[model samples]
Structure formats: structure tokens, C-alpha cells
Target: MAAISEALTLSAGALEVVLAPAIGGSVGAMRWHGIDLMRRLSDDDRDAGNVLGVAMFPMVPYANRIAGNEFDFEGRRWQVLPNNPPERFNVHGSGWKQSWTVARSNAGAATLALEVTGGAEPYSYRAEQAFAVSEKGLSVTMTLTNTGPVAMPFGFGLHPWFDRDRDVTLQFSARRFHLEEPEGVSGDPITLPPELDFAKGGSLPGGWRNNDYGGWTGEAIIRYPSRGAGLRIVADPVFKHLMLYADPTKPCFCLEPQTNASGAFNRGRWNDPDEGVIVLAPGASAAGAVSFAPFALTFPAA
Candidate 1:
């Protein structure tokens, strides 16, 4: 059927992004100058329904892992079965593993939606991802609505893996960093150290880093000198955390703009203001956007 097999494409100027609503509502590909900016998704991978092969995926209802896949909220216990097996926790919520419906699509834009009813859980919600392309690059807007009868904690984020170039550099500002626990869940908050700071904009850390940066200024810069272009990433204020995952030995890196620090559902309920967690009442909704705008870079031959 068309709904199960077709991939939607959106383009503006030289920027293009593809969406596959059938599998996790992810961006299948993103390209500039016919060169991949975001990692490309292959047809084989798509047919196999592999989320890892996609350029990017949306994290919704919640983001990141929940320790032990169980947490207590408002005197009731919520348990989530591990969706990504061999993994002890419930990672990246339920949206990415479920198919989404395309609400609308055009040459330069598309909107996809996923609905989840808590049923036995406590997070009935509706999540939407809207993509728009322009000469400025790509704009992704994520929205979540609490569709259940009770209020619940929720978060929204875009998980984009960018291709790495030898000269690629990153820059962003955050007030603090959340340490990671042995299980990859957020542990405690600490001030940003110079070695981990990108305030001045620099290459990805030479070592592995998988932590959440709090108090993000909602902006980031990524440059690829070999390509003679760079991107200016801007986000809505609601996105208060910038999560960077870099492994020097890897061929890609990720800089995620999200609404709340990971594990906020359990340990951070009391730390609302600073952690950026959103507790929405029934029928209430929240939305934010992230943009990637490209600019040219020039270098003279020696």
C-alpha cells in the first residue's frame, strides 16, 4: 500500500529532506549539493524497518532512558517494557518504534503524526513532526499533546546524526552538564568545565561524551571546512537542553535540542524550573522548532 511503502520528499532550493512515515516517522535523508549532511537511509534498511539507518528520528512523549523501565509519579507506579532489547531501560520513548501517519505533504513540507494511548501505562499522547524546507535550510517543528484524562510529564526532541568531516567544528552555550550514570541515564548536574565547553566553538571532543547540557541557549553552530559550508542551528526557547554525543573514532556526531534533561520524569520532578520538564494537563499541548541554516565558507589555495 502507498501508506506502508512510499517515502515523502520535501525540498527548497538546494536543501532536501525525506521522510518515511511508515517507520518511526524519521527523516530518511537530508542532502545539500547532492552531498549528505545527515546520514543517508538505504532502501534495504527502510524495508527492514531499521530506525538506525535513518538520518534522524524524533524522541517524544519522553526522551532518553528510564532507569529500570519503572518510575513512580503522583503516588502511582508507571512501568515501561524495554523496547530496545538487551538494553535494561526504556529508551527514547514509544514513538520512534511505532508507525506514524502522514497528515499532509508537499514539495517543500510534510507533517506526520503518531498517537499512543497509555492503556496500561500513564502517557496517552499525540506527537507530531512537521518539516519545512527553504533556501535557509531545514526547519523541524515538534509538538506533543497530553490526550489522556490525567496530567503527565512529557518531552520532545530531534535525534539527528550529522556526517563528520575532518574540519567539522561545533559551538554552543550551556550553563551546566548532567553527568551520566552507569546505565546512560542522567545522574547529577555540574558546572560546565572548560574541556567540555564549546562556548567558543570547537571540534567535537577528542574523547567520548554522552551527557546532557542544561540551560542551553537554544543555538548551535556546526562547520564543515572541506565542504566550504557550515550551518547555524537555532531553536525555540522551549528547547532548554543540548545533548551532545560524540565518539572521536566514529564517523558521525549528534547535537540534540530538547525540552528537558533526561530522567526528569523521576528524579527531576522537584527540579522543574532548571531542568525544563513540562507537565501537561489533559488536552494541553506544547511545541518547539529547530532550524538548520547554511552559509558559505571561503578558503584560498596555498
Candidate 2:
């Protein structure tokens, strides 16, 4: 497969951006935050392999390791291929890390597509990814269509690693929380741990975080205290859930806005039963949208 790349410029008032599209359909670079917003690979950067930003598709459970990495769907046990080597489970989705085909390109936005054939599983999916630079912020959309001959279980999300530093404040709203057990414990839902709540807005005290939350009204605010630049992430009411990860030692934190709870397919713990688990029939298609808006915060510099 040949890799294709393109560049585009979008400006809306003070929000001007230069976007680079990689053949892999990933946003290679986003200029904002007074610098390139996305992390680029460099020889001296030890964490260069990290995914700066990618459109998550088909599914978005943190991983499949919990619950034995096995789930019974339609009376058959479907085992997902483990993507996390040490943890022994599948993660994000098959296509986030997989290279995507660039279908169209221009100076303002690019379209990328990918297909996944279920080989021992019970589902197949085709996804179209589009990234556009706008004065509002960076907008990414992923649409998944099921082409297989049966109802398939699926979810979608975005994994954007934001720069983690002492001067950043991450804030979001949630009325309830779901906690993932530490290693060696069973995957079960626990009450809102005191430290994980973000409804009041505060700083994360640097540590490992692999938890999911429900009851999100589909909105969040991330502020870079030093730059006075803040970002607002909003999802349609249909995608009413979100996930937060603040690993101080990892150099970044993830505020993943998702459609359903983690491991929803296997666990059947859809936050909203009616809007949960996208079951697309053969020849059926499903779509959802999420937006990221950048804004200038008026807080005094610390």
C-alpha cells in the first residue's frame, strides 16, 4: 500500500490551523496551542510511538482483558485478538492502529477509509474517517457500516493524547462513574472513587488511570493554564458517555468521549439500553458525530 499525504489551512478569526494528512489517514500534525498541537515522531523523543490523534472506529472499549477477554454473543464465545501484549486483550479498535486508505484529499480536509473482515469473529465492518480543520477547532468523524450477514456488536470513540503537565487543568461533567479494577481483580463496576471525579473541575495528581464514566451530558472542557487556551469537547446527545485517563507518569492524559460503556458488547452494561451496542444488520449503516472546539479561557495565570 502506498502512503499519501496532504496539507490544508483553516482559519476562523484568531483560530488558524495548518493540517497534515498522512496516508494512514491520521492527522500527522495540527498547528495550535501556540505550536504544533499533535506530537510528531522524533529520533530523540522516547515516547514518539504514541498516537498523537486518531479516529477510533467500530469499537471503543478500553480493552478486552477484563472478564477473561472473552464474551458470549449470540450463544457463541467470541475471543478478540489481544492488541495489548502485556495485558493480553484487545484495545481501542482494530483500525485506530491499522493504516487507513486515503480516499480523498484537499487543503481543508481529507477522507480515509478502512475495511475489517471478521475472521473467526461474527462481524465485519467498513469505516470512513474524515478530519477537517475549522475555526471552531479540529473536527473528526467516523462512520461504520456493517456489511456482514448478521447483527454485529460495535462502538466508536477517539483517542487523542493531550500534553500532560502541571499547568493543565482537565474538567468534565458526570453524575456517575465506573471504576476498572486494578490488575489481579475482577472487572466490576464500583462507586465514584474520590479522586476520579471531574464534575467540579481540578487537576489530576499524576498516576495510572484506566477508568470509564457514564452519565456524561456529552461535554467537557480542557484548559492549558499556561497558554490560557482551552478546548471544549462535545458529542451529540446520542453519544452520551465519556472516559477519562490521567496517567501523570505517561506524559499525557486521555479524555475519551464514547457512545457506550467499556466492554459493552460482552458485559451488556450499556449505560443507555436504547442507545447502546450498535447492532447493524447486513447492509445496514450507523453514524455518530463528535466535535472539539478550542477557546480562549479568561483565567488569570498561576
Candidate 3:
């Protein structure tokens, strides 16, 4: 809950890195242009009030709703807790809202770990979160190892909010996409929904927008024309297969790269062939990495 320990101002480029060690492990805070790029979740602050990014995991599906919250996996019924209020469903991952321990810290990076045991029915996992800031950009890697004897289902993803405006363009290579019903309404996929279309590049006209897309090639590019700044997010091809876009009537938008659909654990639809069902044997481990590379486009000084 508390930032037990931290290290800062190291010779690691112009970026300012802060490491906080707590009971769970460690949480690394990276600052760029006075903007907290990642979501800061602590005992006091549980949301990304200032930052624009957060790595999501352990399992990010509607385990508490939609697909019925009951999955017949391997001949067993698993019941997950409902974490979402309005929709009354489970969204994102568990550890994200929980406090993490600060294990180690240096000027460059810090590692945070969280342990969850004996959760609703079949959702127990021990996870480690590592955040690093370098001259290139920010990198977050999470490793979840099943300590339980039984095989449990899980997934991993990241929620990073970016500045969205007329000058910002989001580009990524994908052959297909999935559009979700507004307000978590369950239904058939709307092929190439206007908001879900990013093939030829476009801009956010305005209003609230939230949906999921799949079939990505493991790369995302966000360009800021006015500031001449751009961020390239890359993920392990074997880790992420779906991308969620959410623009909630703000100057920012989220490009979430996920391992499976929001309800894949139960629905069993639209799962990435390359990345699906994260199963870990007792003492076995599954690790995935997400990286953000920032570049300042240079031109002749006016």
C-alpha cells in the first residue's frame, strides 16, 4: 500500500526513474516531460489519475459476467469474482487493483511483486510486475507462475492511455478486428465498425469509444504530429493477440494489447492462435514483455 523504498536521478538518459519497494515487491515510476506515463496504483491512489499507462494481467476477461462466468475447462467449473460495477462483470486483471511489494530498486528500474491466494473458486495466481525506464522509453514485464496444484486459466495485457487529438495518428498492422457492443452488451461481432477501423489511418472525431481488436502483428505506432513525439509499442508475438481501444470523452485514448478477448476465458471465441489460455504447471512460469519506444521527430528548427 505504501511506497516502502525508492531510487532516483540515476545516469540513465534524461528520463527520471523512481523505484518504490513495498510489501508485495516493487513498483517503478517513470517520468517523461513531467508526465507519469504509467498508471500509479497504491493504497492511497488506486487509479491512473495522472499517468497514461498501466499493464493489465493475470486474467482480463468478463469472468464475472457475459459468458456466464462459468467455464467448462478441462471438465471443471470455475467461478470468478465480479469486479466491474456498472456492467456487473469482471474486467482487466486482478493484481492491477491490488497493492504490490517493492522487492528491488535502482536508478534504471524497479520490480514489484504481488501474491494472490485462494480467490473465488478457480482464480489463484502469484504474479511479478517489473517496470523499467531507459533512454528508449518504458518497458513493463509481468511473470505469473501458478503456485496452485490445479491448472487455472489466465491472460495478460496492458492499458496505456495516450494523448489523442487532431495531430495524433494510431497505426498498426492487422488483417481483422473485433468490435464490442456498447456498455458490455453481448452480441455478434460487428465487422469493421467505424470506430474499430484503423486500416487507412483516422482521427477520433469525438465522443466515447471502447472496443477490442484482434489479429495484430505485435506492433503499434502512435504519432504526435504537433509535438513531434511518437511512441512505438511492441509486444511478444506469443503473448498478445488482441488490442482494446477506449477513448472516454477525454483528450486521451487507450491502446490495450491483450492476450485474449475480454471474455475469452468463457466464450472461447476470437482467441489469438499464437496467444491463448495461459496455463502454468505447478512451479512452472509464464512471462511476457511489453515495451514502449519514444522518439522525438526532428526537423529543421524554425
Best by lDDT: 1
Question: What is candidate 2's lDDT per residue for 1-302, written digit by digit as tens?
Answer: 22543334455444444333332344444445554343433423212433334322224322223346566666667676765567665566566555566676565566677777878544578887676666677677778788787776677766555677678887787655666665422244556666777877888666666767767778888788676677788887656567676766676676777765665655755344633566667878767677777777686569
**Candidate 1 structure quality by residue, lDDT tens digits, 1-302:** 23745798898888888888887999999888776777788889988989977889999888888898887767788888888877888888899998998887878988898899986656899998888999889999999999999877788898888887878999899999999888788877899988888999898778888899999999998888887778788999999898898888988888888888877766847446776778898999999999988878778889
TM-score of 2: 0.82
Candidate 3 Cα errors over 4 Å, as ranges: 1-11, 17-30, 33-66, 185-195, 205-207, 269-275, 299-302
Error of 3 at 173 (Å): 1.5
| Poorest lDDT segment (10 consecutive residues) of candidate 3 | 46-55
What is the alpha-carbon lDDT of model 1 when measured against the actual structure?
0.85
lDDT values, one for every candidate: 0.85, 0.60, 0.57
User: What's the C-alpha lDDT at position 66 in model 3?
Assistant: 38
- The lDDT, on a scale of 0 to 1, for candidate 2 is 0.60
What's the true lDDT of residue 171 in model 2?
A: 76
Candidates in descending TM-score order: 1, 2, 3
Error of 1 at 175 (Å): 0.7
